[model samples]
Target: MEISGIGSFLRNRRFGNYLEASFGVNFASPSKVAVKEEVEKKIQSVAFVEDDGIGAVLISWVRIVVCFVTMMFTTFIWALIMLVLFPWPYQRIRQGNIYGHLTGRLLMWILGNPIKIEGSECADEKVIYICNHASPIDIFLIMWLTPTGTVGVAKKEIIWYPLFGQLYFLANHLRIDRSNPSAAIQSMKEAAHTILKNNLSLIIFPEGTRSKSGRLLPFKKGFVHVALQTRRPIVPVVFTGTHRAWRKGSLHVRPAPLNVKYLPPIRTDDWTADKIEDYVKMVHDVYVKNLPESQRPMH
Candidate 1:
């Protein structure tokens, strides 16, 4: 029942910043009972209160409203823009999706989560960028970073998510049906061909669904299959502290410090089909090491 050192240990972590309470942080000789009491207090607060007060709740609703309003118009804007340019070369339309990414930037700024992206320069190459999923804001965060000739892979259910989903489809991004294995495999194959034909980079959440508990889930193998089929380098992306910002069912978006690091790319030239299992685990470990202990898998 005594969780003593967690107070000091978690203080060094970002989630501590989210809760904004420090009992034994950097203390010379702190009482064990005090630390235990404060830890329990913080956990209870995290579970019960997502925001500070009515003002904070109002701000959260304002942020949600502004972003959705902007996204609704933004979706129509992209639709009209792409429709007008339909007769032009397809590349022109492909590159025009940056408008949608701008909406993502708006969300990030209003939510007050500043991004610290490492090795983003790697997005320039024709490769597969595989990121861990933890929040719906993940879509917007990546959109803000996604570059020209880079198409993203998302699930088919995205269509139900207000105008955000419609904007995603209008942007010419690929959607995979995870419910049907045959459909998912066919979708990946088509994704591979699209990458090669258009010379585009692919961004996918290999974990498939956001982790409600903030831990890395067992990675699905579709990304590995695409990497092997296309021979594109895989850039492992790890996002920290997003789960606490906007949780699965939470209505309000609590701002938190977020870091997205693009680890060094993994080349697939030497990878063989026979070692698919090894390949999946290898890439999975990359994310585990880059993530905070709070977000890593329990096993």
Candidate 2:
């Protein structure tokens, strides 16, 4: 399919040249643009069921049943494996990656959603990932895109979940107490220390919670504080179409094309706590400008 609308605008050579000249931002190459176009074509070809008919309703119900069954079965198996490898932290983390990949593939297969990843490739080096939140599926999308040894930072409430919460704890992700400032600060310190000592990458959703309106929300400063403490490069990631696939507060899943794009990383060698809001606004603007008009916030 031909590139149009926001995609065309982003890939335009003149716009890229202007960005490079004005802000020193490097635009995607022609080869990358071609790849994106092909991916878009593939996404467009996927069959999506319209929710207006009884047949569609039945299909959606069946899909939910299959997804729930698959998730429960996978979580049980994953928990067993974690139990077996609990004695070794590094081994558990490595095995978690394998289980994570399998679960991600299984969930996507059941939903009939194809994930298209674009932009900067993830390397083995340690860094901080800041991403826009839209749906619960964002975690799975991130897992499928990132390499092994990357841990996520989640709220303390997630620990109260049943089987999934146990697995998350066993997976060794960082959990922060959002209700208490001192505890949250301590969690960030421990998270930074874990990243440095274990040589692992961390993913943080700066918005803190999923966006109900499918638009990027104002970012919280927790992620910025973590980046500053760790002195790591911040990689910004954006997710499109996930909210439509499995929307917030919705029980049904739909077939939708999901895209995960990784932007250039921002180095924090000379950043200070006083400049945190400015940096957050800068990254927020990147999402506002790059997201398609349909997905952009209605102001």
TM-score of each: 0.79, 0.82
lDDT of 2 by residue, 1-299 (tens): 32122222332333234334433334455685664565566556766554746676677678878877887898899889888888887656655655565666556556666666667464435788888888878876665455567777899888788766888888777889888878887888888888888877888898888899788788887877888888988888888888888888877677677777888788889998899889888778888887877677777
Candidate 2 has a TM-score of: 0.82
What is residue 281's positional error in candidate 1, in angstroms?
Answer: 0.6
* Residue 95 in candidate 2, Cα distance off native in Å: 2.1
Local accuracy of candidate 1 as per-residue lDDT tens digits, 1-299: 22222322322233333223322232233685565465455433433245668898789889988877877776787778766665553443354445634566666766765444556656557889988888878877776666556788888888787766765666677888888878898889998988887787898989888898889999988998898889999988788878877888987788665677788889999888899889999999888888999999998
What are the lDDT figures for the candidates, one per model?
0.72, 0.72
Name the regions of candidate 1 deviating beyond 4 angstroms. Answer: 1-51, 87-89
lDDT at residue 279 of model 2 (Cα atoms): 86
* Error in Å for residue 233 of model 1: 0.2
Off by over 4 Å in 2: 1-38, 44-50, 120-124
